[model samples]
Target: MNSGDLPPSRPLLVVDDDRKLCGLIRDYLAPRGWQVDMRHTGPEGLEAASTGDYEAVLLDVMMPGMDGFEVLRELRKTSTIPVLMLTAMGEEADRIVGLELGADDYLPKTFSSRELLARLRAVTRRSVRSGEAADAGKEWSAGDLTLNEETHLVTLDGGNLELTALEFAILASLLKAKGRVKSREALLEEVSDRRFDVFDRSIDVHVSQLRRKLGDDPKQPRFIHTIRGVGYKLKEPA
Candidate 1:
């Protein structure tokens, strides 16, 4: 069929061993203009993700060889393509690990199709928005840390820090509000354009990753601080 006869397709890669679930997702997303490709093995998924022209990847945490975390680690070595992780329900550790490893977001395996669609849209949208903002040439600095929005480059102590897209977004959000506390809810909405869930700890995970990259000690933070019972803030250099 011609492009006009159907909605514009957004290509997505789904890396999952559950053939049944993959089929269900394909059936549900095909009509909605998502061209979903499924890979049943982690190595296969990693290969496809590296070579494919996909807007995002839907990765399952459980797989035989290499697993999703390994696949993600390998993939991030080369690509900044958005990734959404699928973890078992209530598996907080899995979710946190996935986020720390640079997955854009995570959903429980028991998620509804509607939630799946929403999460996918959120990750992709965040990716696009970040790209646009990065092209704007805006720059922000706090302490010895500097972030260049246009180039998506961050430097600490005159050295470059390799940050994932989500990490950049979270750090940029904090730098923009330097000296002002930004609640996790505010950061989540600002970075992902999604409603905040009080129970969700993905934002915290990302923040911790950012802290490590910034060489900020959580107990004696120099760049970012955790305001107990509140959220986080970029410390204004004294």
Candidate 2:
């Protein structure tokens, strides 16, 4: 497809040292409505990401010179773009490290092509939609939290809280539907475009991390409250 015909809104970057693997992933994911870009090193990936054009980054964990973790740290220093790390099988520690370093998700090596496509779509959808100006300047308030949809920023108790892309989306979704309980399935759909699976615990993990970042106690959440078997709700601060 020509540049004009490309889905600019769905552009994604795949960063891996493996030239063959990168080519394979880029080829496999291109026809699925994503404009895929490939990078062969962490520095190159970081430079591309710094441009702030790509919707999301699919980063590989192992690379020479600058590893994925180091790259992740550097990217987090300046950007909040959604990042999904590609780890090797049984590398649970690497996966956990990537998550704690602020990656939005993880996909171990030997992952299914279909699953990768699903995740790429889900992540790109979330990123492309987050900064979208929907109902501009509409105010959404929950508890001590307030969001200006136009500005796309949040304040907790009158203080600015640094939030990543997924964190902001999760909170925005919860605030947009304050009061009613939103099941995990619904929340997953809200964050991504896909339906929920019993094995998919990533949303829960994200919610938990968001709550922690927001300094809300799960036992008595001041902003987001869990609904046990159902999902969660954004508690309007009194």
Candidate 3:
């Protein structure tokens, strides 16, 4: 295909200590709309990813000098780049840890080419959605909770709350449709372009974490209410 006919290449960073694996990834993604960059150490990855140049990062869990979790935790402090964590096959704990540390998505280390592309696209899509929402409005509020979409800040009862990117998106989505039902399918579509798998509970998990940050109870909730089989709705401002 001619260069003009190819989709625009997105800058992508792959952070892994395995030199051979990094090279393999670069070869695989370079022509598939991703201009892949490789980083072999955790510190190097952290520095490169913090530069705000790449559209996404594929971070491996195991690395020398520093681990992926540590890098993700530190990166989240300053940047909101989409991060897809690569964990050892079946390491559910690692996946959970990565998500808690602000990773946008997870993939198994033995991932197929298709799976990797899908995940990379999904995380980037999520990031884009969040950025669009940020520019859509300055601030959204309900009761004592407030989210500054422009500033990417969340506060409850005047106290600042630390929230992950996913948490922020979930909350912002809820507030944007305040007092209206946001079905799980609709919310998932907004977050990523991935195909729907009803069994996926990541959205629920994120919402629960957001509620904990707001000190909201699932029963008689103060900010978010579960719409049973539908999805969730943010309580309207009092």
Task: State TM-scores per candidate.
Answer: 0.91, 0.82, 0.79
Instruction: Write one digit per residue (lDDT tens) for candidate 1, span 1-238.
Output: 3443325589999999999999999998898789999999999999999999999999999998779999999998889899999999899999989998989998899999888888787788777766675558799998788998877778988999888778888998898888899999998988877788888887899899889988888999888999987899898766
Name the top TM-score candidate.
1
Which residues of candidate 2, in runs, are more than 4 Å off? Answer: 1-11, 29-36, 90-96
Better of 1 and 3 by TM-score: 1
The alpha-carbon lDDT assigned to residue 109 of candidate 3 equals 85
Ten-residue stretch with the least lDDT total in model 3: 1-10
Cα-based lDDT for every prediction: 0.88, 0.81, 0.81
Model 2 quality (TM-score)? 0.82
Specify the poorest-scoring 10-residue window by lDDT in model 1: 1-10
lDDT of 1: 0.88
Residue pairs with clashing backbones, model 2: 143-236, 143-237
Q: Model 1, residue 4: displacement in angstroms?
A: 17
| lDDT for residue 197 in candidate 2, whole number 0-100 | 81
Give Cα distance to truth, residue 43, candidate 1, Å.
0.4
